[model samples]
Target chain A: MTAAATAEPTRRDFLYIATAAVGSVGAAAALSPLVSQMNPDASTIAAGAPVDVDLGSIQPGQIIQVFWRSKPIFIFNRTPKDIKLAQDADWQSLRDPQPDSARVKQGHEQWLVVIGICTHLGCIPLPHQGGFDGWFCPCHGSQYDSSGRIRQGPAPLNLQLPPYEFLSASRIRIGENSQA
Target chain B: MSGYSTYKPQSPFMQWLERRLPIASLIHSSFIAYPTPRNLNYWWTFGGILTFMLGVQIVTGVVLAMHYTPQVDFAFDSVESIMRDVNYGWLLRYIHANGASFFFLAVYIHIARGMYYGSYKEPREVLWILGVILYLLMVVTGFMGYVLPWGQMSFWAATVITNLFSALPGIGDPIVTWLWGGYAVGNPTLNRFYSLHYLLPFIIAGVVVLHIWALHVVGQNNPTGVEPKTEKDTVAFTPYATVKDAFFIGLFCILFAYFIFYIPNYLQHSDNYIPANPGQTPTHIVPEWYYLPFYAILRAIPNKLAGVIALGLAIISLAFLPWLDTSRVRSANYRPAYRVFLLVFFAAVIGLGYLGSQEPTGGYVIAARILTLYYFGFLYVILPLLGLFETTKPLPNSISESVLREGSPAGASAPASGA
Candidate 1:
């Protein structure tokens, strides 16, 4: 193809190149309206802004679901044994290999918070259902360890960790990516 | 291209403008005075009708978009308001909705016309491939548009179809998440689909310009499938082709208006009236009528991945058609064996579409499997085999012979030289 083109340009060849170039440029210029739309709008971003959850009322060993930006967020108040189990589980053979230590915030491991939605196909994973006792996606049979690492089935990643921080002994803030 | 120039400016200012941009000359050469085969039928007019339909869809779609919200909470209500509250919004919304159905209606006929006439053969391969590209765009745009109303069928259809991508091994989950921009098909997915749904029609329009440009470059293929041979074989596109296209456009508009006015929901699913609830899935989840035939092919296979592959191949096969049927003859009119297969192929498609709409069951599944076999068999097996083995009728000496044989002179035929 290169050799054929290297030979002097036929009129048709010129027309093809010129029209393709012109069409491509026109397409690029026309795409701004759509490309600009994907950027998070003020209202949508504002909806996902930092939300504070009252951890004071929640008892140990219990998990509750909260909504931020229309996504379900799971806040788990882990007991001492729950924290030890999550940290001590073998991390060598995970579908998404991340250690328990890496998942939770340093010195705040007792308050385990993760996005409630399953990574397999985005269905909400039911808590305390799998062999690992983390979560189980009924939609696609994905199992997550207590650390939220995918343990089995078709899911390729662990439950996503939302940007969150401990606000106090009894409250936590989500959707803010910063050291509090 | 055929060398026919319809422009000759007498006024000095017009001549100066012509020399600068030659817009008048381009239009004159491409449309007004272009040479078309004299024996062309109403089937040939569908290309013009499709062009008109595209414009109508874009105009109506743009107006509908102004009042339509993209959020999941408000999308269903917004559509209801468009139907109930907005001034003449019902007319515009119905026209846009039914216009999509009519657009596909015209396109299918247009495609069948090309297939029957062998318009995809040599020198026209690029033209046909561009059409396939246009078709894919239409499918994507149409799918996204269906999801925008945020109805029961729309949500589940989006769920089912999006999950089809997860049939891919390993990479599937990440791709789905990336597509959704989150764990589920929530705000991000809807926003992106809305943006793309709005964007693709203009892209279709752009490709259409290319389709027409290529048409002008190579010229139209007639029912005879023979290239024009001399001046007597063809007529100028101006009054002759224009008049035919106009008449057909009028007839097509009548059909389009009837559906919009009397039966706007005829093509829509009854389930779509209910607002989208992600938790509840309709028992009989089906795609639109235009997509049914392919949907049937998808469900015929029990395996999920294979079903997706089969569904994809049904469309991909069309792109390779120009090379698939290796016959020197272009028109099926001359190939009696080919003609029989084409009719059966058309029926098989319609049958598959019907099976698709009904719930897949014992008989339906078995029938879909058989029809699916025949559908692929026609393109992959029968078409190629017939091309090699079948005996075609003797060709007319020229396009003029074919045209003159049809009747007397249809009009003032500005015959062009050479096939």
Candidate 2:
């Protein structure tokens, strides 16, 4: 047994290792399809295609919810006061700190587009409800500011921004973003 | 480990089969002729009760699944149709649903019995750990099973639970999306959860087999925490243990039947009857009552990532208990201080569970925090420290001594059943 332990690697050992390695690779390759099949399928991906929201009908201080990829998207047409209140609040002192300008398009600051799901848990927040005048999650007491930044609650981050770019001044396409 | 098996086949065919397979003799040695400590009380019956509950859940779940639809659009209506249309469907659905609660109830009692008797100590650690694995599987299986109806509580519970993965730093969001199988909890999510719900119970059954195997290897821990030193200390597992188990199982089944026949939906949340709507959440979203203690632990912490970790640790901590508890004494009956602490620990867990159902508000949050502290402190701090300092009461030299001290003839009658 000692001699066997001290001896150089034999052809049988190499064969065993080679067979085991190849078998593992084969097993992994077989499992890949089974595992990846659970991911977003072609139709689900197609269903999540960029939705075009026509912002022409929106009035100031109005927040209209639209479904994009089965998630509620809150399109808040921020009034001048709403935008000012969002900007004037000390961004650094907030729970999830981000400047209002960073959240919305610099020129399109009046139009705040955010995925309306609560950051703490994925419940759709009630718009214009909470002390922050943005959203309040009823499931847990997570609150968001008018700029969609988390103000005061258990939520750890700002309300997420969907990928969107301005098609024209009054039109935007969600799920597609372009450089400023 | 107990006594030598004297299994002799009675007939030619059985003898031949036994020579070839020996499965009958194996069962004879393990179950029929196995030497069980005569001192095992009603608490020991939970193992058999749990096995029965598992079978009950599986048979009922499989029948319910035959009629249940796993689509987002049809899942809720499918359950409704099962209640109204399918023959004996409501019975199967109620049995399967309530079976989950009673199953957890039995497991909790079983665990408490183990802790009280220090059954998780050295020789039985593997058995305890396997039980923990079964418990974790049961939790996941139960969660997914609740998601099958696609009700308000089910959908939101899935969303929030799957989002727990998002508490991880960099890969969190991707993992959450992977779990959902799409952008959000919808058709794909429901389908995968249904598939897994069906698959997990069988895995639990497998683990339970190992749990029993481990139990048989170590043998049952008795109230005295004393190992059987002589044949008189033990009784054959057949008529004695089986009869006791059957009696308790009958009583347990009566309770289970009462829940199913009379107040079937009493344990269930009324909000679950409402169809799952992604746009609106229930006024207060809570998980099944079995999960309340851990849920309370999760919400006790204010931070998201930390809370998720705390929740995971709450379950995982039980696996480490065999080592955390450094007491040489096996049973709480011998450990005076440990017994008091054990009862307090039970109360804290019950308190936290109550807090979990209430709204997470000012007074409730504070209460939950206090209980959560005691919950962890009892396991991590008190258990380890008490073992080293506290003096234990005098223990019986052997299992038979304890039984004799009680003036019970059960142990003496063991040898009367001569093979």
The candidate maximizing TM-score is: 2
Per-model C-alpha lDDT, please?
0.82, 0.90
The lowest-lDDT stretch of 10 consecutive residues in candidate 1 chain B is B410-419
For A1-180, candidate 2 gives per-residue lDDT tens digits of 343575798777788899999999999999999888878888888999999999999999999989999999999999999999999999999887789889999799999999989988788888888898788887667889899999877788899999999999999999998774
Model 2 earns a TM-score of 0.95
Cα lDDT tens digits for candidate 2, B31-137: 88998888788888999999999999999988998999999999999999999999999888999999999999999999998988899998999999999999999
- DockQ of candidate 2 (2 decimals): 0.72
List all candidate RMSDs to the true structure: 9.0, 3.4
Clashing pairs in 1: B231-B415
TM-score per candidate, in order? 0.73, 0.95
Q: What is the DockQ score, from 0 to 1, of model 1?
A: 0.07
- Every candidate's DockQ is 0.07, 0.72
lDDT of 1 by residue, B222-275 (tens): 878899888788888888999889999999999999999999899999999999
Native contacts matched by each model:
0.03, 0.71
Runs of candidate 1 with Cα error greater than 4 angstroms are A1-180, B408-419
Task: Candidate 2: list runs displaced more than 4 Å.
Answer: A1-6, B1-3, B411-419
lDDT of 1 by residue, A1-180 (tens): 564656688777888899999999999989986666545556665666789999888888898888876667888888888888888887776657788888888888888888876554346677888788788765445678777778865566778899988778778888886774
